[model samples]
Target: MSHSYHVYILASKRNGTLYIGVTNNLAARIFAHRNLRGSAFTKKYRVTRLVHIEPFNDVRDAIAREKALKKWNRG
Candidate 1:
């Protein structure tokens, strides 16, 4: 199966630490963060709950969306 790219945000909790990332496999990526894998930032901040996600057919669009979310004020 072909996988689409996704821009996603993970939070430690509601209104807590936020992390923005782009991934081709959303489930596996989230799982890794949750399990405290190789992600230093996410693991250090304990940001594991999936809060937001935007799917993109193109890698450029996914990266752009991730960048946009990174600039958003945490709410």
Candidate 2:
């Protein structure tokens, strides 16, 4: 069996605060975020809306994509 990782983007609202993250368990991560247990930033900003998700075969690739997305998000 093979495993896939995900690079996901969450938004507070339409065009609102954005968050970039990587996870092997997308559903669980999103659940945690929505329940205020994933990240402090998400909990504070209410960034629980999933705007985008990308799948990768490797965790490293998922992390790299998350980092790149964050860089783009910053600027």
Which is the leading candidate under lDDT? 2
**TM-score of every model?**
0.89, 0.90
Model 2 lDDT per residue over 1-59, tens place: 55589899999999899988998899999999999999999999999999998989999
Go through the candidates in order and give each one's C-alpha lDDT: 0.86, 0.90
Question: Which parts of model 2 are misplaced by more than 4 Å?
Answer: 1-3, 73-75
Minimal lDDT window, size 10, model 1: 66-75
lDDT of 2: 0.90
Cα lDDT for residue 7, candidate 2: 90
**What's the TM for model 1?**
0.89
Maximum-TM-score candidate: 2
Clashing pairs in 1: none
